[model samples]
Target: MIGLEGALYPWRFRLVLALLALMVGAIAWRMLDLQVLDHDFLKAHGDARSVRHIPIPAHRGLITDRNGEPLAVSTPVTTLWANGKELQAAREQWPTLAAALGQDPANFAARLEQNKEREFMYLVRGLTPEKGQSVLDLKVPGVYAIEEFRRFYPAGEVAAHVVGFTDIDDRGREGMELAYEDWLAGVPGKRQVLKDRRGKLIKDVQVAQNAKAGKALALSIDLRLQYLAHRELRNALLEHDAKAGSLVMVDVKTGEVLAMVNHPTYNPNNRRNLTPAAMRNRAMIDVFEPGSTIKPLSMAAALETGRWKPSDIVQVGNGTLQIGRYSIRDVSRTQGQALDLTGILINSSNVGMSKVAFDVGGAQLFEVFTKLGFGRDTGLGFPGERVGNLPNHRQWRQAETATLSYGYGLSVTAVQLAHAYAALGNGGAMTPLSMIRVDSKPGTMQVVSANVAKTLQGMLQEVTESPRGAVRARVPGYHVAGKSGTARKTSVGTKGYQANSYRSLFAGFAPAQDPRIALVVVIDEPGKGAYYGGLISAPVFSRVMAGSLRLMNIAPDNLPLPEQKLAAAGQGGRN
Candidate 1:
């Protein structure tokens, strides 16, 4: 202290200076390396820890019916997310935050503990805006709300099968929603931001990408008709005590589907109890034997060969048909002594149908069936749309061919039947069926000449007007034409058909001349006293088709109740 130079040791002083210089040099070299030599690599590593590339979710599109009623909509919603570490560090704020999120504080703490290693976690995936803001007002560190969309169906189960639905992540799962997913889902966007170690977004670094909202979709479905079909199908199922049911209606002019419904359908909005059984769209996915409904088409095919006439008579003695060892019988059939082509269709005689099918031959019958949209996808682009089984004509045995004529050897979906019958209404030209609204007209394929279609239309008219026709199928103020079918369902776990299990179906078009609408109704395994298609399915078709035709403002072709003494004036009683 008396003399600093005299007291200080030179060697120790030199050593200290050298140590300071070494430290300075080491720091300078590190700065140079970071600033120039390895600058990009270091910066990247730093950014990895402090910067986050966040997803900017693009909003989804809307779906509307042909009348512009919203069937599906994407509503804005907020999702609450959090950083596990930060949320855990602020234990004092846990109760407030958990309460705002409607979660128990103790359970939330346990969840935080379990996911401590994770940097990000979802607290609530979908929340209303009000609820989300309430959670953010708590000011809990590391908690954030991300904007997203929740798909909602306005028509509920009434349009469930046609409109389909989306999952919680806003992705299509079934029906038309899945069929046009690419067209409805828009491109997503992205952005970059700076975050602190605790995972709080400090500032926006840059906009990495821009977002694009999804395109709106317009369907060919008429929501009003859909509701009508849905309600009528449910009522029929309940009245008949049926196991299941399906219905389809199409615009004959454009082949646009107006309504498609299935019994036991689930509510798309409430997805809490979903099952494969309830979700199955029987109209487009399942197939069944069509019974006497095939009579008209068989006649059409025979007439195409120029060998059959509407006036040609067939002897349907005792109303029983025999082919090989298999015998086909009707349900208490009358007017069986002699039936012309029109009378055979009107009465739905199995024996008469067999006779006509034989005249057409197996190859011709197969061609007619294939041309009617059986055994192939209808090209509606719906997921799980079935191509109903139709064995090649080369495999047809005498019994098989006869049974096929009566709708036993082959099967057809409700939509397939609608497609075929709609073609008849559209001058024998089958147009491509569509679920979405089209800007251009759909193409058509001529399956039969217009002359044949006119002749067939007249014959079908007899089905509703003849003294021994399906009286229940007639709409009082309109000239309705359709055929009734009754068939036995195949037994479970067995190849043969069940005696008591029956499927009832009615298919045809209305305003008979200049037909505008065609529909098919199928009820499976009716447990009630009446299981025949005329008794079960025809009444439903009458109500729905009549209501629909009236709603569309179509001019009535038949006389009003007061003027028409038809019901009182010798109208045919149902068989």
Candidate 2:
């Protein structure tokens, strides 16, 4: 019995010792794997769990007008963020946070609990400083505030379309903001902070990066001119009972846009009910058939080719010329008989202009129009600028060619047409139109011969002086040369134009002898018993020109009336 007991005890002791050795080996292997092979993975997991990244928002830039009036500015705001796990643990205290944030406690609690696994989450974005301070005062676990910027437009609706606005992230989203986003949007930075086990920021660690503020942008637009144009455009819209209106004033020498005003403008500061149409910069985006305003270009092309003179007479047969299956007629059928080239433009004779365009051929017409910068971007740095549609010569039918000559079939933006007219005013030199005044030498391209331009200027002056012409566009005490255009709005897929619905346009440069400023005014479907450009748009042009000239202190060359001669009595008596 003593021998059996000894043997059993020895066997049990050996088995126990083997099991102990195996367990020790397994523990050693695990230590080796975790401490050596899986060291990096564990270290990363620990770092992710403890380290917090705080985004350092860069201060958004300011946008100023030419005279240094702030159009758009960035004001300080606060962004609320939280550690999801800590926020969920402090769910009972969320009501305090929610009340400070003006959010429902249940909803806020759900949001916090929903993303507990996430290391960080934005509780609220773009909070006012006061509200953010209130939230900070609550001292809720895991809740924190960071400095950010919110865009503010001081001029508000007055400069809405031009200055544009930014998104909640302080990113440029529209207008000049979108155009210069890269230069205006500075580099975003980050800040690292050390946190305790309770998810409280113990202390600020070393700053990982520093935020660089964006560069301020200065626009070429004048605030005074912009305000004046806005007031006038708004008044014109109401008075004429028009659907919409846009006016642009350009510096002839530099092509700098002085003012660009569109009716039905909205406040960029508070865009609660912003419409796509209200956001549109019609001066750059909307295109229309140019009607008689294009006659000067066509006639200039004809004159430039040495094919027609101002005195050249075309016998317009009862103000109608049949081209192919279509017949082009004058706006006024009552006017009859032969009309000279000057008379044709003065009378806005489509028949005579069509005959001249037919004589000039499409190739020459296309070349001239292309040189004037039609069917191409104007490089004005505006958003959504349409190049408009100018059909190629190959695509042009005989009738299309004739119709195009008198400003049909082809379309152009108001800015493009203004630039073209400005070229005419600037001694036949085309300057690059710019909305931002960059310090650089002005580049001028010779589009029309000086002689031809001078002659056309004379003819356009006559167009204003003639009885049936846009005489009302003439500013008193100043020589104003311009043309009025009334085009029927064309419907898509329809063969004909819409009656009673018209686009009225007046394009001119004041002090015609030596042009100073080139302006264009357009009214869409004026309801005040006048859809004619001479009646609607020309008057606005006149008022704006008069005001601009007076403001600029431009000396009137034709001012101071001459004394009436008594010889007129003798002349009348002799007759």
Candidate 3:
């Protein structure tokens, strides 16, 4: 054992071996003290002197249309930040940094003074890689570029209302962006890493927190249909010289918003001096009295009473019926002295509709309207959705009930109106609407009996094929069923309604027998010659629906047999 461990023949060799053993033992003891006994303290000391906890910016989610077309995206960008303390001492580097950042040197110095108490200050944000490299090439002290994300909108104004823009801090401000803020903006993480004297990344010690990228979101919007709706709505706005307008289309089967657009739209990318009124999603936020479009729903309500029939006669003597102070009248006697339920709608006779509502009473009408999702939000979860008002049954007077029958005395958002019509077209079942792509089929809620809604659907077709129908709304190869609305705008700051301002609207479903889609077209304050929904709104509806139906590959429901030449004459569209 002695020979294996050490040779002890010479005293010089023995002494050398003994000294070496003592030195090795001392070194091992010191290592044990540091590695086991005082490990936590030693590690903490080393980290305090040489380690940094750097934050990793979380990447935001991408937003794409249902068909995979990108509406909003986040591109990799570099954000230049500076250590205020280090920069304070690098006075000579200020000009080089300021010039690279496109800032006046004096202004940059003043900003540094303002942020002197802060450890970090942003020198530049959202810079291109090339630009960041140039700034770094100048070798400005205390300045570093961080890899971050900046949102980019490819569809621009076409989808501004749906995919709202984010702020400079990468937070959502409006539309879907605001609605899904947390889902799109993920949690940022931090890493414990070492850096050299020049602040260059060295070795990664450990991750304090793992960075999680935001999950991508897919919308229900069809970008192709959105473009079509936007183009048509814009053309109508310019042609009529209208103040504003909006258009919405829903897939009846899915209750998905295929297209939603508003005129006077602004680009989401460059939002300078953007007005709230202009930024508003009119289809979901703006509510207006629906005029005659309510006629179909009213008709459906009347039929639901079991006391009224579609063929029941409504006496129209001289086309006027006086209800105390209100005079419910048809424009002229052009409609027959007496007409059936279908005639009342085809003629848009206020007297006929008022009489029906009077017979049905206020409670029944309210029931049907509420079931159709009026007086409440559509639950689309869209930002700024307005729940329109519906007066309590006790508050509704006889005349008020009469006016409500013809789409007055209460207001409705365009999407609500469309959803109601879509309900009727979908066999009296209402599907919950959504802006996101739902994987499962949405459950349906029964709004009215299938027979009642179906009967109303058939009568609505007469509005486009009868002698007094809205011919412009007729598609070349599809059976269209729809109703027109022309309501006078209530005075903004006064009690009475406006004399000339009107909201023209058309709501309907195509292929009346087997509807696949429902559309709503509204033009606010149309002024060029014609203001009637039949003339202004229906034409836009026709153009948009034709393109949209074709884009969806829906088979045409009407053949080459030309429809009867019709015009909305003699019948009054006013409620």
Candidate 4:
């Protein structure tokens, strides 16, 4: 019986050993599956347990003026982010962290509790470097600060319209920012870092790719001229008691915008109180019906057609003429029944200009105006520019045609009108208006005959020198040439005009004999008892022109003679 019991015990022990070996083999197989066969899934699970990703921002480009002055720049900043899961787990410490960061403790805890599943979340952006350092020194479990860039506009409102502003993430939002987003937003790169069990950045592994900064943009805006124009426009708005004003100065030769200023401008840095009206770059975006300023183009067409000469006589008919159901009249009635073309321009006769348009005909008039860059986009590359309205010949009624002859029934931007005048000043060559200089050679288009342009220049001079016109636009030492326009603002849903609401415009070029800078000034709804362009807009033009000329070191057209001779000549002439 003992032998039999011993043999049974050996068998039992063998059976137990076999079962334990089977258990060990099963455990090894499962381990191999998880560590090797299903490696991706298990690795992802492990990463979910310990690894975290933080977004890295690429620095935005710098915006500089033509002379390399910084208009917009990017400065180092700190952004606060958090691992929501960890922040929620460390709830007790959140109160202290919130107080140190000057945040509401309740809200901070609530936000972390609400988004605990999210691995990454932003708490604050665009904090100064010092503030970010203070946040970092807190050594909170989940809160972290990273280096970033915040855009800074050094020129403030002066360059606001041109340079534009960026979003919190350094993305371009308007103006040049929106226009050149791809060029301004640089490539983003990644960084591989090791983290400890508590989710702290323990070791920085090899960087995947080094981040590259964005390319800098050098604009064609002249800072000095821009400041000058802004100051003058602000003063003009105040003096005229105007609702708003815009002034644009263009270099005739290169079509570079030397300065563009709009009153009621808003700083892009702080746009909390900005209105759509304040953000409007009226010089490029707003269009008005040009008024008598359109006369020169009509006169140019008539002269080009060989149907009229500067000295040719026409019956002005008591400063009034009727065409179909509409009647056109001059500002003042003169005794002359007939007047030459120069006399018509000098008096700014609506009747004479309408007759000139009639002789030139609708087709020819439209062709000439279109050729002179009216009612078209100047391709200046500014955002929100309008391609001002001009009706086709098929759309024209007799009244429309007649009124358009003297700058009505058609809309044009201030920049377009200034460029048209520049074309006339630059001997009929139409250069592309530019806000940024291009490295490629610029091309020119011939818009009018040089002879015709010279004749138009003389006619514009007559308008400035005329007693009833824009005499105030004249510079003291230069032969100024320009025109005045006062158009009643059309009220919405109304057939007639609004009382005391007018857009007054003064457009011209300076040193009239050989024109240099072409300028346009527009005042919206002047309330200083005078709404006329000659009164509200012309003086602003004069001041800007004088300052620009002096800044550019242009020689004065008139030089003072010896005091004794000048005084003697004046006395003798009086005698």
Candidate 5:
């Protein structure tokens, strides 16, 4: 019985050995097939699962002021994403991930379900690097973070309108940002990276394409002047309880915009509950009837006709003129006054300007306005820049002609008005306005004769220097040349003008003897105290101009004789 049992045990052992050998041979054959015969295909399939061509985010360009101070910049950040299907598999870890993301777990779950068919979904965007790292450290399956950039504004709302803002993905959205998007947004790159099953990056394999960062953009805005303009415009709005306001400053010689500000502005940094009204760059977009601000240009047109000199008298009887279908009356009490061109401007006599326009004729007046950069592009290339309405001369009715003479029946933006005034200050040469810095002197067009510009400059000086003119626009010790406009606001949803609402405007240049800067201020619907341009907008002009001239080290033209002599010696006739 023992021998029979031993024989059976050996037979069992042989049977077991044969089975083990067959299993080993099958395993070896399978290994050889995978590693040799199907090596490339299997490796490619594995790499398709583990390796990824990840995008390397390129840093956005820097937006700097003329002085090299950063207005808009990109800061390093991270965006966390998840493979929806993989993340759904790790349902137990959803709560932990949701807590780390500062999201409700149920909402996170719902979001995941909504995007379950999507291979990839953004879990959270624009997180701080440190915080993003902490979430990745949790090692949740399918969770991953990619390097990105977030736009930051250092000047905040002060330069928001001009420098503009970018989106969460660092794309330019408004202002110069939107205008120069291609120049600012750089090309992204790609690289092969090996990732684990949990979607965690293991190592970079190879750079398929190198990333190229965006180029730096330098704007014409002077930070100092911008802040000053912002403060003064904001304060003026508060002081007058005005609905809105806009201010623009330009270099008379270069036509570079030095400062531009608008009220009801928004902080580009935090755009929560942002309104569209708050984001408008009013100086560039909003238009208003320039009122008496157009008188100077009308006077220029009158002068260009060679029929009326600056001293030519126009009969302004009873301070009213009856054009067809319109009875235009002067706001100032210049009753039965026969005033010259200068007197008419000083008094802002609608009757006097109407006579001038009538004498010049509509065709000639429209021609002059066209030459003065009206009803045409300012060549700023800015987004939403409106060329204010100017009617054709052939279409002008008698009332249209009269109203056009005294700055009605037409519209203009603050920048356009400022640009026109800058042409006057720049010896009748029109330089295309620039939002970017001009390293060299820009080319200019001779819109009007230098003699005509000089003559108008002298006349405009009286508008600020004379007691009857915009006296509030006077900056101490500086000769101011500007016009004051108190235009009636057009009624909303109606044809005629509103009785109570008005737009107060002041457009001018400083140091009339040798104008260095031209500025325009517009205060919409002043609800407190005085509403005249001389009273509301002119004072703001005064304050901002005073600071701006001092900052530019411009010599004051109205200094006392001895002080003037001293300044001339110090400046060496530079002014």
Candidate 6:
């Protein structure tokens, strides 16, 4: 029995030894796999949990006016973010964090649950630096703040349509902002970062790339003139109870838009309730039949033919001219008169201009208008600028030509009108319009003969300087030259004109001896009482021009009765 027991013990001991050997082998294999064979895989998994590629936000550039006044500036702000998985574990701290973030606790929890699968989530964006830092002060796990930029407009609604606004992500959405996005948007950077198990940032490991700050942009707009235009336009809209209005002032020589303002403009800084209508830059976007404001262009076309002179008499029999199923009539006051070129303009004579347009014919008129920058880009590089319709001359009939002469059967934007008038004031030289400050003078094209442009300028002056003229547009100390246009608005879904709706317009330049600036005012649907361009838009032009001339330091040309007479004599006026 002793021998059997001893043999059984040995067998048991051998079995135990074999089992221990197998366990040691398995442990050795696991160590070899982890330390060598699967080392890269394990390390990669660990890095995936703790190492993150963090984005470094780049600063956006500034937007300044021509005088370096800040129109749009980037203010540093904070964006609160979190790791949803890690944040869910710290549910107890959610209430404190949410309260500091100005979010309801229940909503915060629900948001966390909604984004639980996401490693990164934004809690709030575009908070002020102080407000964002206060939330970070709570020291909540899984919560973080990334520095970002929020665009602020100093001019507010006054320059909103020009400078435009950026989205919450600091992306340009409209105006010069959107037009120059690539020039303004900077490149973001990336860095490797180390984080703890709770997704809290421990350290910035290494910067993979450096952020590139955006470049600064300077616009051609003068803030002072912009404010003046804004005030005058807003006042006119309110006074006339108009639907909307737009004003554009241009330096006739430089082709720089000094001020462009639109009524119903939105506050770029706060666009919570922004509508498309309020955000539209109508001075460049809206198109209308320019009415008698275009008669000067027609007269310019006539004079360019060399067959008609400013002194040539146009026989108007009873103020009406019939052509191809259409009858054009002027106001009864100036009917049945033998009006010359200057007289035609002074009376705003549709019949007389129609006769001149017929003699000049369609092709010559179209050529002149085309050269004057109608139906083309203003070279502003602005977004959504409408090229108003100027139908091909080949498409014109006698009726269409007459209507076009009187500013119908075609459309033009306020910017286009301002540009054309600027060319007229610049002695028939058309330059590229600019929305940015020009370091050098822009190249110009001879759109009309200098003699024709000079003669036309004199006639335009007579429209405002004569006894029977647009006296409301006259600036006190300046000799103003412009035309008044009371255009009937086209029907919405039809071809005819709206009976009562009209677009009041005035396009003119000041200090008529040496034209410095050209301004155009368009008031749409003046509903309160007045609708004539002489009544509604001309006054606005006067007020704005007065302020603008003062701001520009242009000497009043009409000062001193002797100088006025000398200037008028040199300029060749009828009255």
Q: Give each model a TM-score.
A: 0.89, 0.86, 0.88, 0.88, 0.89, 0.89
For candidate 1, the per-residue lDDT at 407 reads 86
Provide the lowest-lDDT 10-residue window in model 2.
Answer: 557-566
lDDT string, candidate 2, 384-495, tens digits: 8899998886665779889889898899988899999999999889999988864676999999988898888888988887787888888888888889898889976888
Per-residue lDDT tens digits for candidate 4, residues 40-97, read: 8888887676665555667788888888999988888988899998887677788888
Local accuracy of candidate 3 as per-residue lDDT tens digits, 98-121 = 888899989899999888767677
Q: What tens digits encode model 5's per-residue C-alpha lDDT throughout 1-575? A: 86787687888768878999999999999899999887987999999999999889998899999999999999999899988887878889988989999999999899999988777899999999999999999998888788999999999999989988888888888999999999999899999999988666799899999989999999999999999999999999998999999999999999999999999999999999789999999998988899999999988888887888887788888898876667989887743468988999999998889988887777777887888888888898999999999888656677878888888888888998999999999999999999999999789999888999999999999988888888999899898899999998998798998988999999999889999899999999999868999899999999999999999999877768988789879899675
lDDT accuracy of residue 191 in candidate 1: 87
Candidate 1 residue pairs in backbone clash: none
Number of residue pairs clashing in candidate 5, backbone atoms closer than 3 angstroms, sequence gap of 3 or more or interchain: 1
- How high is the CA lDDT of each candidate model? 0.87, 0.86, 0.88, 0.84, 0.90, 0.90
Q: Which model is ahead, 1 or 6, in terms of lDDT?
A: 6
- Candidate 3 similarity to native, TM-score: 0.88
How far off is residue 3 in model 2, in Å? Answer: 24
**Clash number by candidate, in order:** 0, 0, 0, 0, 1, 0
lDDT of 1 at 28: 98
- Between prediction 3 and prediction 4, the one with superior lDDT is 3
Indicate whether candidate 3 or candidate 6 has the larger TM-score.
6
Off by over 4 Å in 3: 1-36, 195-208, 561-575
lDDT of 3: 0.88
